[model samples]
Target chain A: MDIGYAFLMCSMLGILASIAFSIAYLMGSDTRKIVKKANFAISTFTLLSFFTLLYYFLVRDFSVRYVFLYSDTHLPLVYTISAVWAGREGSLLLWLLYISIFIVLSTRRLDKLDKVTAFANIIMCTVAAFFNFLLLTSSNPFVRLGFHPPEGYGLNPLLRTPEMAIHPPAIFLGYAGMTVPFAFAIAATYYREEWVKRARNYLLVAWAFLGFGILLGAWWAYKTLGWGGYWGWDPVENSSLLPWLTASALLHGVIVEERKRGMKLLNYALAVVTFDLVILATFITRSGIISSVHAFARNKEAYAYMVLIVLSLLLGLVVYIKRKDFFEYDHSYRLRERLIQGSVLIFALSTVTVLVGTLTPLLMHASVTRGFYRHIEIPLGTALVVLLGVCVIAYRESMLRKSVLHSLVAGTLAGIVCFVLTKLSLASLGVGIFVFSLVGVIQGYSSRKIDLRRAGAIAAHLGLILLFIGVMGSWMYESSYTNINMGVGQSVHAGDYTLKLNGFREVNGNAKFDVVAYVSVYRDGKLVGVMHPKLIIYNLMRSDRIVASVDIISLPLEDIYIAMGGVTPQGVASFEFYVVPLVSFVWIGSLLIIAGGILAALQRREEKARKGVVDAEGEG
Target chain B: MKKLSILVGVVVIVFGIALAMSFKSELCPYVTVSYVVSKGEVRNVQVNGTIVPNSTKILPNNTLMFNLSDGKTEMRVIYHGILSHYQEGIPAVVVGSYYDGVFHAKEVLLKCPSKYKVAEENYSTSKVLSKG
Candidate 1:
């Protein structure tokens, strides 16, 4: 066995030991010391194995089969590092690393631990061991090639971007981090009320990372896919959205459970479902059961993930069945609380819709189009925005008149803006609701003395509104001018902008040969920028593959997006230009949401410990 | 409370019906060129086929014209979009329909075959063919 394989074996052994010790601790044994040591050992061995694999990539060890498959001598240092997770086996290792790290973090402060924590530790250890088992059995990265080649097959040319390098790990971190909440949910069902408080931060971090990961994926798609749109409702994309929607709902539902001791069972169910969706996402992306642009491969490893999903759901159902009293709806909510419940309900329904759309292909051999999602989700999203506005306004005592007046004013202003920006359509009403909610958030924030959680909520709400506006403007008002064949120094009018093709040149680099076409974007007869859209030919073993790189100029109102289709032999170039409006808001809004999530996750320990007392005397 | 529950039930039923309708309307089957040819005049279908070698050319109107085959049947395809990942003999899923003896493709999806469980023998062969 090689060094990497040896390290992974040790890691697997440590995981198995930790599982045994944690279970023994759960079964009235004083193996706490052993459990902790085993946990630490698992972390250390996994880290060592991970680094050893990275070492293989860095040294360009073609003798290692994974390195031989994904890395080459000519790859940059950063990409060489990313090449560690560029394949199925290495990414599974990355998942193991995250699981080990989270396992240590979640079980760090436990002594005289309750049965719940012990149970949680056991579940977490078992999960880590399960993934390790997968690595050892099916998707091991340490297989040897027996003979070192002169060079290796390079990483996919599309995945050589900074965003692509970071996307998979961010997504895997989100997937791995979700186990803490799920384990806590199952453990808390064993008789504890502390899971809501304990699992909240883990849930928040996973939800935030998942959101940011989806954003990065969208951004990368817009940049590299040469398509004018970001989210294409691809099955894999829908899989990621499935967990995000449920987790978002669960995030809100836990607040209810923590505060009012209501929706406890629902919160547990959400946690379980979110975790299941994470596995489902993995299965869809890897199984090739349904075709997606991000297909990994159909493999036995995917079947293992599918079994894990079923077992997780079964475990959740058993716990839920055992704890029937937790399902009692004990408290009548206030108007604001009810609105939040409505919003959560909408999120849950949207999750169901997306799940059906995603799985329909596997069931019926027919895929649902983007129209299917938009037709249902847009109205649901609009209702959510309206509920958000009303929910914010309902925080005050005299809300009816103030809310009506505020919503009217925000709606009128947003209507006018939408009318001027694009054509006034039914979507303007949705934009108006977004603006209403945004204004309500601003007003509520300015009027009240708030804590970090409240401020973070407001920031996140504002960010969502901005993101909604961005989605509405970009998807609805987007226009493209394709088949714009131009010679050098030729200018053509494309909507509100003029695209002047200046020249073409070729450059041969060590990794890629680029044929870049320079085009000057002008608005109102003034030069905005010289954008160079390139046709990149990545130098690969035995062949070269040509891909188009998009050049975008982010104007104040619209982005001038250009991609060169091809350059003819006569020096004439064909181009596709897109005017995408308010696309920057998607990015800026995503950053705000992430920052808000992080801010909320980093709440003071005292604040988190402050539990909301249930007033039994209140009306039910 | 009972009346509210009834109202919610009605609203849910109505919404579910609408969702089912939209889903039915939006269902696009993934098929092959032979299936499309057999069906004849199929609409809103995704056809998977291999790009015929040396069959790709830019038409006079700047649209891309190529021949797509599924080993048995080959059909002409007219695509308006830019497909930077197109390679001869590589598998592609084209979303559109077959009508008037030609497939008018709205979108073409091509993913890297190296990532697949299936061996990339076709990809290597296409590379060799391109070189030749």
Candidate 2:
């Protein structure tokens, strides 16, 4: 028997045992110790199996089919590690490994095995078992080749970047972390009223990971795809966004549920839908049902994923319908509460639009144009930004007039500055909303006594405003100069920037050869720097594939992006140049959003500690 | 609160109707070359086909013209953008309108050939190396 296969089998058995034991505990058996042991056993077996697969990649074991497909003798150590998850089988193993890790974290403190914890553990174990069954049956990473080849195929040149190494892991972490809140919700339907509070923190952490993962993917596309655009709304991309949108809605809806114990159905449904969307995303990406650039080749795993989706949805609906009394609550909503609820509705609407657009090709046999998404998103996003400003400012009703006055002034000043810089007439509205949100955040800080949760919310809202501003600037007024043929030492002017092609050089690396163009960029006759846009020819298993590598000269306000379209042996090159403005704010704003989410999660812990201290004092 | 909820509901309803109208207008049917030809001229549609080998040409002013085939019928496609990954014998999905017997594509989406495939045995080992 293969060692990795044996380890995986043990892990699968361990999960089955854990699931059975958890069910036993839930059925009034004193099986806490047994369930904990089973959970720890599965985690160990899963860790061993994951490392075993990684070990095969590192050792260049061509006898293993997966290693033979995605690894090579000349592949670097870091990429060799990354190749462990580059394919369908390896990535599924990576996801299962994350599930096991989260399982250990959830079940480790089983001494106080309450009903909610027991139910959550059971749900987690059941999810783990499903993935384990997938690995053992259809998509096993440990299948041995009939014979060992001399050299293995290398990883795709596109995925040979640093970002790809972390992107899949971050996304899988987010996907797996969602199971916790989902488990909590399912358990809470029959059990605890305060489960939303605990589930909110987990959701925050997962939402932060999902958001950061998406931005990383977008950044990778901008830097590598050579399209000069960050987002294309591809089906695979929309699949990920679907879950993030639902998670965002759930995060907001939990605030209402945690405070007033109302909107329970909204919170529960969002949690369930978020988890189901994650599975749906996986199915869409892996099943090849959708024709996306990022989709895996058509496989049988999609059927299993569809089954999982239906089962989970049925489970969620059944559990939700059983608890009719949790939906009954009467509470008067404040203005701030109304604004937050409005934000949640906006997120839900966005999710629905993107979902419909993504599925239209499959269902209606029609492709939704980019115009469809932009038409919906622009107005919805702007309204959400405005609500963010109003929500923060509505903290004090007495200062509403003064806040409006300040916001108007700030917005006008920002609009004037933007007009002077870009000389564009249509940017005033976007800048006004951005500045209004900024003023609201500033006032939000000034009026509060340093509450971390509020501070985090303000930071997140400001980050979103900046991101919106970046999108507006880059998309609306982007300038492109295509098919500019230039020779050595020849200069061309493109929208206030001059590019002089210095020369082209060829260099041979370990596994690839590069044709690099050295072009000096100048603004107003002053030399800025030389940017090298290259064409990389990677020697793969049977052919040499040519890939264009774009070079970007990022200024504070804009990025001078260039791609060597086709360079001839005589040194004449056709280049594509683009001036993408305010794109840097997208990165900066996304990072701040992730940071704010994490800070909010941390604030929950601090608040819990303070409450615990107060309760202890009262007992004393 | 009730009044505000009603106002929000009205806004969402109006927005949804507008959105549905825009979506209906923007949706382009995914069709084939034979379908487009059988139906005469199409205003907007998406067609997936393989690029005929040696039929791709760079026209004047960098407009790309190619012959696209869906195994049954072939059609002419004209595009005005830079497709860095464009190659012969590769599958591509082009979004455009078919008129005057030519598919004027607004965008071209190329499918990378080396995504995920089983390594074929007895493969040609000859390297087709390009200078630049």
TM-score of each: 0.92, 0.94
For residues A384-434, what per-residue lDDT tens digits would candidate 2 score against the true structure? 888887778887888877997898789889888878886777787788889
Instruction: Write model 1 residue lDDT over B59-113, tens digit each, in one string.
Output: 6775789999999999999997555345677777788989999999987765432
Write one digit per residue (lDDT tens) for candidate 1, span A25-56: 77788887777788888889999999999998
Model 1: pairs clashing at backbone N, Cα or C within 3 Å:
none
Classify candidate 1 by CAPRI docking class. acceptable
Query: Model 2: iRMSD?
Result: 6.7
| Docking level for model 2 | acceptable
Query: After superposition, which runs of candidate 1 have C-alpha atoms over 4 Å from their true positions?
Result: A287-289, A292-298, A416-423, A542-544, A606-620, B54-58, B81-88, B110-132
| Predicted complexes: DockQ each | 0.34, 0.36
True contacts kept of each: 0.39, 0.39
Poorest stretch of ten by lDDT in candidate 1 chain B:
B113-122
